[model samples]
Target: MKQFQNNSLYYDVDVKIIKQSEHCIFYEMRNDEGKGSIKSYQVFPGIKLTYNDFHMGQCPYHNPLHKDILEINHCREGRFECNFINGMYTYLGEGDLAVNTMVNNRIIDSTFPLEHYHGVSILIDLEDAAKMISPILKDISIDLYILRDKLCAGDRCFIIRAKNSIQHIFSELYTIPDEVKYGYFKLKVLELLLFLSIIDTSEQFEKRTYFQKNQVNKIKQIKQFLTQHIEYHFTLKELSKRFDISLNSMNSCFKAVYGIPIYAYIRTYRMQVAASMLLQSQYSITVIAGNVGYENSSKFASAFKAVMHISPSTYRKSH
Candidate 1:
């Protein structure tokens, strides 16, 4: 295993290159939170496609190495938080897409809200890509600079919520045969850019909610409190009073951060906990239900089926 030192090309202190080949590099990062790996493939001149898989809560602090670069990210699973330098935060959930230039709009912090994320990032070295792409096919024109201006004008990050057109382009990327991956990547990248070029920015740009730091902190605290005492259920009013935040703000911010409502998140979390206990322990379903704040085993079984798609007994037996 050769070690690609931190800060060598584009990485900061939190990552190291674990493997490398002719046209691919595998980078891994580990910290107190957890670990992740990025598999990068050089497909075209000044353009690369990277598959990002992280089991950790936070990514390594990113410091853009290139001055002229455009990053397009597609979230295939989990939620991603982008903390801007202007003291604002936004998130990218599954099937969402984000387009931005690293020069003007910089991300101060990047984290996975659910502590796990699987996604794809296409990094374009603007200067080099702009010069190289157009001449490849005279009939189809691709101008990187124009695409940047159209998508990320005024340093604003352009986000498109999950649409079938975008999904059609990205879904194939996750499952490509190794022998044809290199050629398929070129075709797909070009297809994506062509689609973006003709995209009506006016209709595609979504009004994303941005949360303030103070509100985000309070919401996080509320999450920790609720998760720590998962055996108890609390009302929105009670949580609002305990956290000293308004009721409406709590709902919106929690959804923004975790991509779900408070009731839904906790219910899913409790079921997950119950599922784990089911497999790992010899505890009966009634005891497990009570531990997760469900007084009735029948009710617990129903909820577990709703979330886990199987009864607690069946789930344990299958696993």
Candidate 2:
């Protein structure tokens, strides 16, 4: 086991890598009060784990770590407020799991000590995770669309149970003989994966309106292709030809799953990309528009305004 420790609110934290393999790493950490802790993992490239702790009587401040992190917080104990970029605040109780997609802006507030309020977090590399779940990615995407913006408490319970099971396995590692620990740890990890798979399935069944696994998978592939080539103008006919589906069928699939047409999704994706560039880069309006596949700056501005209700220039200025 490798151990790392520090002692500063801005940087103080300790991590112990209990076990590691080619595909996954098992680690634990204690974060500093009023500070955020972030660590990247080689086990799953492109994935990182971050932990933040807030002392009682102090409110957690917003600390921006510029990366697309999928935060999974399993609140071991205590109450906290999750403040999102959209100005929505969620109250998280003990045994709750908070999934935050690091898209725009977000923060967490806790009125408890670092040790008192603890949680386990797992960050799966987006591309790697996509490949690992490729067989079911489309179904998951469709389920996400149907479940949009609602998290059931039962889902949280399932996640908590899985987390605890993993923790329990870790806790026994030292007590048990080293030879037994290896075998038991492997078993526990397999069990955890199976539990996660079951949770994913349950969430899908509970949330999705239509659950055609095969069709959903195809839609996922299309979405992935579009995301990869967002700069290129893609027509329904072109996409249909490439995916071997009729134009009508392609459009219907997208609409049924995402509640939007393919063109609308592309336009929205372009605007979102442009918005990010405007906030994070020094690129000019015309350059940003063209970078996101908009040939005409005026056309891009018009489409952005239609969805956002604000001009691109104004939006950039405000953010």
Index of the highest-lDDT prediction: 1
**Model 2: worst 10 consecutive residues (lDDT sum):** 3-12
| Local lDDT at 178 for model 1 | 92
lDDT of 2 by residue, 74-142 (tens): 554544444333333344445555454544443433233112444444444344444544354444432
- Give the Å error, residue 95, model 1: 0.7
Q: Which 10 successive residues of model 1 have the least lDDT summed?
A: 1-10
Could you tell me the lDDT of residue 147 within candidate 2? 25
Off by over 4 Å in 2: 1-211
User: lDDT score, residue 243, model 2?
Assistant: 82
Candidate lDDT values, in order: 0.88, 0.51
Top candidate (TM-score) = 1
Model 1: which residue pairs collide? Answer: none
